[model samples]
Target: MPDRHVTRSGDDYAEAFSLLLPQGQAWPRDEGSTLMKVVRGLSQIWGVVETSASKLLEIESDPRITIDLLPDWERNWGLPDPCYKEPLTIDDRQRALVQRMTIEGAQSREFFISAAAYIGYSITITEYRPFMVGLDRCGDSRVYGDGTEPMYSDTFVVGSIPVCNPNGDPVALDELSEWPNYGLGPDTIRHYWTVHVHQARLTWFRCSGGQCGVDPHLRIGLATDLECLLRRWKPAHTEIIFDYSGLTPGDPMAGTP
Candidate 1:
């Protein structure tokens, strides 16, 4: 049978109790009667129980509500990510599991931005395209440095994709500091792009949505959690260079260690 819920007040419970008593006994109808007071007290006790039951129901299913059952929810969702640092707070864990379950996966810039937002990072995607003389302006950067050389698609050999020489004699995709439009190797410009990761901002906790003792102390949490997810979900044909040039030079990127 399904749970049939009914919210009742102390007065309602008292009336029900009064009905249970034997009709032979003369029960006082006045609110000041001793029996009435005893009944009201008992009824109010059950009111506390009712309040607890309602609260339990609210927290039972929603990941955001319950803190103790987070492990169970994460386990069921295949979370507590072994590869990355686990979230420090209850809010972090809940957000991770919730996002993981809801994200169906997509191959678009917007999808990645929203996904990164869930991880607490703001990002923008920059796709690289070689300049075409007829379409591009004079001030625009050219793939061949001066736009004199004709851009042609290089043959991609299976399992033989060229790699930058370790000794630096011949440069590869990211050997140059600013990614020189022209490189000595095959044109892999189409195979690469930049994801500008914005600087982390402070999120203050408010009483409305903030969990006491939880959100107040909660920082922006971790950036790697989202970075790893983005890297994992990116299309296989291309590579992404994370540009964390928010305020200063952020974490290590392409050419850097």
Candidate 2:
């Protein structure tokens, strides 16, 4: 997910795709689009979902230490903060839903439990950590109908949580130029995909037990721990968003005429 860069491939060719719907497509209006809708539209090919509970284990108490650790933890990772604004406060329903998800996700893996506990321990000592992390959805658009069909493919990363400003100053069509394209395809019409997701990171640490506990190599241990967890956890696709409105709800994907 951190690898958002478009790399050149065979014969210096590269491409990406996106799905956009014309106005007047059908779907009921709500406060906003549901998380299920966004998650379902992603490509089914390859994705990495490192839950908040899993990451919670890597942090420790002490704001000073975490502040110091931030730069190092993020070394070589160029995660862009395109919004340049603070997180909007999610309503109680959303908060409860997120907490329930983290808890249930931890139940599936002991490592996630350990990670969640570690974050809980750190939160008792510090204030900057988030309660949840990494709510994302991505799918392979190159194939369709349970991935049996093959076509051009593309990948996208959600930059931030979806926010609605019903009364805030309207962002003009040209104003959206600043946001990075999902980089779907060279021809721009060969394939289509869409994504909207949220992510957070907390820090904590513990032990794996065994030998070398006396002078354990922290970095190596951490790497090994993450690798093992990734191997065992695989997310199953549970939903899909069809119909053109999924590409852009409430408004035509093409924007104002």
Candidate 3:
């Protein structure tokens, strides 16, 4: 077994005190004597220093073994976790600290999956590649016309335009009260991936780790932490779609690489 603390010991304090005494005038080294009282009083200061040093070692050992320094560590790590912000329990704070201890900035699939895990979500990633070979970087936007909409046919609704903001009333021959000024190239489907979340992050009461009224286990809500984290860290060129169907991938050919 290991010592739980470091103690300043082995007669050093007492011996030094005796050394300063007049030569051959017997120093009262026994308990409860005046010189003994002085030695013990001096040892108290050393004791406090030793105890604090030991606690510092324990705190530096791991985030979970923290003492009064937990809040300080969180501040240094820039936590209160910008992604999730509901829980304020000891367990939740400790878990957040552990997650942040090893976090490295990344954009890999595995990195995002682990990031979601930190916020108690189960998610899967799906990658996409455009099947259109001649598509340039400035690809066309997809307008799903079934060859039946007014824009795809000669059928006309008066003052109707193919521009966005279809519901707005027409301002002029071809203008609308709110017409979109620009278009997006490479429709989202071609430049995006989807995150299929399998279940809600539901927390029930726990017996092993529950506190009387503080352990933050009654959670039941659709939290946006995972979505926020993923969106913030995803590749700049890629977009993200979230599926809350709680079912397998509905895409016919979707497969993990």
TM-score of each: 0.59, 0.17, 0.58
Residues 60-99, model 1: lDDT tens digits:
4677646657789888989887645632455556666777
List clashing residue pairs in candidate 1. Answer: none
Q: What does the lDDT read for residue 256 in candidate 3?
A: 13
Question: By the TM-score metric, which is better: model 1 or model 2?
Answer: 1
Q: Residues 1-257, candidate 2: write the lDDT tens digits.
A: 23233322321210111123323435322324553244334422222222222223333121122322333332323211222132211121122223333543431223333442322210011001122223312432221212211211122233432211111122232232112222333433212222111111222122321124333222111122222332333233212111222221222221110
Q: Pick the candidate with the highest TM-score.
A: 1
Error of 3 at 165 (Å): 39
Candidate RMSDs in order: 11.0, 33.4, 15.4
Worst-scoring 10-residue span by lDDT in model 1:
144-153
Worst 10 residues of 2 by lDDT: 121-130
By descending TM-score, how would the candidates be arranged? 1, 3, 2
Local accuracy by lDDT, each model: 0.58, 0.25, 0.58
* Residue range 1-257, candidate 3, lDDT tens digits: 24476456434566566667775446666677788777767766766777677767765556875646778889988888877755545555667788778777796566777677566666766555434433322433323343323342112234543422222212233332231222344545556767878756655555533466675546653647778777888888888989887743323232111
TM-score of 3: 0.58
